[model samples]
Target: MRRRAWLHVAVLAALVAAATPFTAGAAASAAGRSSTSASPTLMAPVTRTFTFNGTPQSYTVPAGAVVTITADGAGGATINCTYTGKGGTGGRVVTTLPATSAPTTYTLTVGGSGGKGCTPSHSGGAGGYNGGGRGGPVLVDGTGFDGGGGGGASSVAANGQLLVVAAGGGGSGGVVLGGPPTGNGGDGGPDGTAGTAGGARPNAGVGGGGGGGGSTS
Candidate 1:
């Protein structure tokens, strides 16, 4: 009886010793898994703004990043000299950009406001930055009436490819002696329309229409 009890106790001890390593290994693996799951990698969000500077600007972004782009074209210039027509407003655009797998660089072209003052008689206004058109001039009773300049277009590009564009507004035109009410300026892109011409009066210079804004597809 004594021998049998000793044999039973030795077997039980051996079993416990064999199971100890497996239980400890399982507990260690579970702890490692918990630690790994507690911490994760995250990406930060980015935001930027662009404005007219008469030159192209550059921006860089991370790979697989989502981007939102908004652009606005410049407004046409007005003539403070006389009771001339008012300039048109610029166009606005908002869009979402596609994600790129590699780090990307984008080029920005901001629109410039139209120039003021042409000069002398029958002298037209200068074009705005980017793609704005020139303004029309007039002469009435041998007196010169200078015209206002057109606004410029804004655009964005990626890898030398054009992504989007917002068109500019048309400039104000001059008046005629008995001309049609005052001349009206053209609206900006999307609706890109031309300005109205001045009315005809004997011995009075006839005014020309302002150029239309550029359009995008």
Candidate 2:
């Protein structure tokens, strides 16, 4: 009985000795693998705005990202020819981008407002134009009136693709005559073309109509 007890004690000690190295090594391995950083949490949505027309911008969409864009047209300058040129239109767009294996860079642009101005007299220098500003006629030689300019359109681009567009406003008409006539300015549509200028009656005075605004496709 005493010999058997001694054998059992020796066997138990050998087994514990063998298991001790493995248990210590596993604990050390687990400790080494642990991270210092905390778990990830949700973040708020992102947004950006463009006030000028036709300005180019760039951004990247991350995993599980949603995007929205809004574009507004500039108002046409008020004038007193026979009529005034109208203001430009505004628009909005929304889209979702899928996750990419790697971060993808996207090209973006926002449209600007057209310029507005007039000639000095029956004959004068050229006025400014761009984006939404359509060229109006420059009356000269005869005793006629001046004219107004049209507004410009806007555009939104994502990943080099056109997503949305807001149309431009129209220009007003110009007229000069012998009798007294009302001079009114043209206002732009919400998302459409502009109105024509107030014209002369029965071949009375000298003047021309304003141009229409642009659109997105």
Candidate 3:
């Protein structure tokens, strides 16, 4: 009888030992899963905001000079810009001049018409010498719901002698309830107009076309 009891106790001890490992393994697996789920994901940095006035303005760049401009977008959209340059003998002429080593002064201007029904949150492109004008807003269901056109280019001569001018086109306006639901505004005219405004819908609006940039001797 004593031997039988001892044999039974040994069998129970063995079973308990065998079960302990499985329980420990299950707990470890659960912990690992939890740790993986709790990990955080990294993301890229956000772009900074910029803004510019849609007015006809002028700026001067000395000979062998360079400049950069920035603008902010409205309705969670990005802004765009264009550049042009002209040179002359006296008082900066709008001629087909090339970049030079000496410093010369050239004037820059920016202007654009009113956008149609689209929001007025867009900035006009920069202009020099003879930049083209911007286009009108996009048509929304024939409701004239679009952005305004960019300013036209100037017809000035470089070096006060030869006529060297570059004009950009205006940008198209945005649309709503159109195809694909997430309608966007038309892009700015190439090499002329200012940046176009973004559509007001949930998705991002089309970017405005940049004006043509040039340099004169």
| By TM-score: ranked, best first | 1, 2, 3
The 10-residue segment of model 1 with minimum total lDDT is 1-10
lDDT of each: 0.56, 0.39, 0.26
Per-model tally of clashing residue pairs: 0, 19, 59
lDDT rank order: 1, 2, 3
> Which segments of candidate 2 are over 4 A away from where they belong?
1-41, 80-108, 120-133, 139-142, 177-205
Best by lDDT: 1
Which candidate has the highest TM-score of all? 1
TM-scores of the candidates in the order shown = 0.69, 0.56, 0.26
Worst ten in a row by lDDT for model 2: 1-10
Residue 63, candidate 2: Cα error in Å is 3.2
Expressed as tens digits, the lDDT of each residue in 183-211 for candidate 3 is 22223222323333333333343323322
Tens digit of per-residue lDDT, candidate 2, span 1-217 = 0000000000001101122222235666777864333433334555654444245556665543444444444443334444343332322223343333444445544333333335525422122122444434444445454444444445545556765454444444444544344233344343433323323223434444444444442
lDDT of 2 at 166: 47
